[model samples]
Target: EITGLDDKDTVFRTVPSDDYQGRALARTLKEKGYDKVAVAYINNDYGTGLANAFKAEFEAQGGEIAGFAAHEDGKASYRSNLAELSSGGADTLVIFDYGDGTGLTILRQALENGFFEKFVGGDGMKSDAPINELGAENLATFVASSPVGEKSDSLDIFNDAYKAAGGDPDAIFVTTSYDAAFLLALAVEKAGGDKAGVSAALREISNGEGEAILPGEWEKAKKLIAAGTAIDYKGAAGDHNFDAAGDVPGTYALFEVGADGFEVMVEMK
Candidate 1:
């Protein structure tokens, strides 16, 4: 979505692209009855790509984009930027930047300057930094869109294992990260340790047509691979049914700041 790296044959992602996330964010805002909003994005591939996608979809769905602009990271002040964004009479501001970096700066300035009454963010803004830095009470109207793995036995198995290892299964990107590593191992096994064959093997192992292999089923997967039987991986995140581009469609949810941290507010379509 951002870098277009999925076009490369050697590249395979266990995670979904920002294209899906952008659309999901737009749908979330619209469903929540926000008819007008402003968008602020970082001046990079990730931010620009998601911002544009959201703008296109939101406008197509009869929503109004009051303002849109990109900003450089590491700026000490974003007050002017926030003012410009809020000038179009939009009470909601959507941000496409990382919460731990320039996004935090922008958000802080926005709040102090009273630029917008409500706030929204993409996955990048779904971080603990904001709640810790700004306080959850001050962010009651803040929400973010993030990918959520589909509920399944595969997810349950992975969650249990992750917990037993003293890790937080709910951590962001943990499921996808684990799935990527496991899939790579499976690809290596299916390719008989040939690096050059790993890409092709990756496609064959999870193309949605084969024996279903769940999390923690390494022995079963290895046996199937050695026996020349195709095995499709049901990953902890989701069934990684890779498309022609080796990309997986994603499911998303809207989350809001809570007393403990972020809590799911609703599932996004």
Candidate 2:
């Protein structure tokens, strides 16, 4: 929703934008080198946007989409649509949906019915439902494209504090929430304490302006701001440098289920 708000002072993101996510999916599809693909998307804006983006990129990369279908969300079953999607002789199927509950059921049902063995998906499939339902061995053929951060020393400090504060370090968006909250607070302080001043302050402190501020150094950060120091606040998730469009670029990776659990197959560049 916050995309293309470069003219305004709005900056909103805990996760990646949809366009990058589609590119991530396309990247994973190319990595697996599937010549023919089929798509099963949730009949919604999110799914449609991803479907179009993935279709364009995948085809541009010399891949063929043999079939495409959209299934309603929250349905008990999608066997009919799954069968149709897989009937085009495509070796790989890409399902685009919020997969925790609705899409997981469909994927498992498709697998149970022997619809297809290989799949390429997005961050929506980052949940445990797929593995829990299909088992890791069965899900080994599935590959996921999603955001994953590079290893950072700051994450250790934040994770330590997170555990102490009764927060689950393994939880989704834990790092993002922490980073955003602290960055907003720091920006507010630097902006002289008001929503009116926060927009510019956020950019001032985040985009490599002055001295680098690491995690757990908020007190020092405040002092530096008080001293008229334009300090850059690098959180546990690394830099929060919002660009001209108030969007921060993030990394992508391919995730696949292994014997134990999800493992990073490759960090996409």
Best by lDDT: 1
Query: How high is the lDDT of residue 229 in model 2?
Result: 81
Worst 10 residues of 2 by lDDT: 6-15
lDDT of each: 0.89, 0.78
lDDT (Cα, tens digit) per residue for candidate 1, span 1-269:
42365455787787788877898789788988999999999999899989998999999989999999999989888888898899999999999999999998888888898899999999999998999899999999999988777899999999998999998776688899999999999999999999999989998998888999999899999999899998999999898877777788867889998888889899888
- Structural similarity to truth (TM-score) of each candidate: 0.96, 0.90
Taking the tens digit of each residue's C-alpha lDDT, what string does model 2 give over 164-244?
999766445567777788888898999888888898888898887799887789899999999998898777766778866
User: Model 1: how far is 36 from its true place, Å?
Assistant: 0.4
The C-alpha local distance difference test score for the whole of candidate 2 amounts to 0.78
Please name the candidate that would achieve the greatest TM-score relative to the true structure.
Answer: 1
Could you tell me the lDDT of residue 117 within candidate 1? Answer: 92
